[model samples]
Target: MHEAKSQNISILSYLANRFDTPVMAHIAFVGINKSFLGHYVGAHEVMHDVMTKLNGTRRLGLPSRMIDRLILVFTVSCCWLAAWLDINVLSIVESFAGPAGAIILLLLPMYAVRRVPALAPYRGRISNVFVTVIGIFTVSAIFYGLLG
Candidate 1:
């Protein structure tokens, strides 16, 4: 039991690192592990309960869904910041593509997601991607409008 828990923690840590966001990784781990550990620890008490127990105390925090949304927003903001900074790095793309191109880039992911049924199951991940694309485009447009 202890070994299994340790292994699960390791896996969660690995996933967290891979995602580059520990909170999101923890959310994923809780969501996925809730089902797997349900049988052993009662079906009614899963991730939330187990996490509380593991930590020895529960801390007040935003609900999981809210946290997920926040993560998406944060990711998008970061992407926007990156794109804004990239105007200095890739001036040529900004010069040629201009605001119109930026708008196209922003809307592209949303268009693809709506058109592609296969991406439905991964909506959360897709939303992150969409937001990122939108952020980049928005920043690019702003940069073009300001500089060009």
Candidate 2:
């Protein structure tokens, strides 16, 4: 919550500085409510997905409801600790965003197109090669920037 608020203010501050008008930033911030809600919804969905996958593994003897509660509590505690410790949010994002985005947005779609029967008809398109090349380049560039 604190991070989100600070991020919003920093964005608004950037807009104001860029435009040389606080009024414009305020106007833009009005439209930011949608983005703010989207972030929260995305986080919720990701957490739910994690819980679902962990429950499916059945490696733990715990009940599904108990596992979900435990995950929720753990997530909340981690968030609280990060906030209290003033961890650098951007560093955390930088560490995970590259690999996660590459896998989720790039690799998975390509895999589905190539291997899934329902998506088989879409395979062998020139766009697939183009997108794969672009995705690889983007991910490579991200890693290069992080490393160099």
Candidate 3:
């Protein structure tokens, strides 16, 4: 039991570190409440809570949740601004890294989350949201590419 628990913690920590940049960059550039941002943020928070609980520490405060929601709102507003400026944020990422890269950008973190045993209970919800977000982004990107 102890060994399994430790392994889970290590995996979660690895995933959290790996996912940190992409999550931040996505929110910073592409905005949130769209794509997989909400799901990703939720997964991250859940992982954090799990880690804290495992360590026998307090769960994160409500303030953290509020901040996350606020960031989502801010990102959605920024998306509107980007549209006004004729900037296709997804396209920009695709331009630099290609379609596969964009898809991988979204999938990598999700794959990491799926690997954590601690998250097994929430796997169904996580995967459903993940697939939905990926589908939405894929269709939009393809349409945007074809039209643009």
lDDT of each: 0.59, 0.74, 0.58
Report the C-alpha lDDT of model 3 over 1-148, residue by residue, as the tens digit. 3442444323333444557755555444454335457766676577556555544555444455665565557657776797678664444664656555655666555665678887677566756586758856875787687678
> RMSD (Cα, Å) of candidate 1?
22.3
lDDT per residue as tens, model 2, 1-148: 3544456345565667666997967766776657656775677678777776776785655666775677568767877897788887666676788878986898679888998999989999999998888888878888888889
Model 3: lDDT of residue 20: 71
Which residue pairs show collisions in model 1? none
Candidate 2, residue 42: how far the Cα is off, in Å: 6.5
Misplaced by over 4 Å in model 1 are: 1-96, 126-148
Q: Model 3 Cα displacement at 111 (Å)? A: 20
Q: lDDT order of candidates, best first? A: 2, 1, 3
Deviation of model 3 at 6, angstroms: 53
Worst 10 residues of 1 by lDDT: 1-10
Best by TM-score: 2
- TM-score list, all predictions: 0.23, 0.52, 0.26
TM-score of 3: 0.26
lDDT for predicted candidate 3 compared with the true structure: 0.58
For candidate 3, list the clashing residue pairs, or say none.
Answer: none
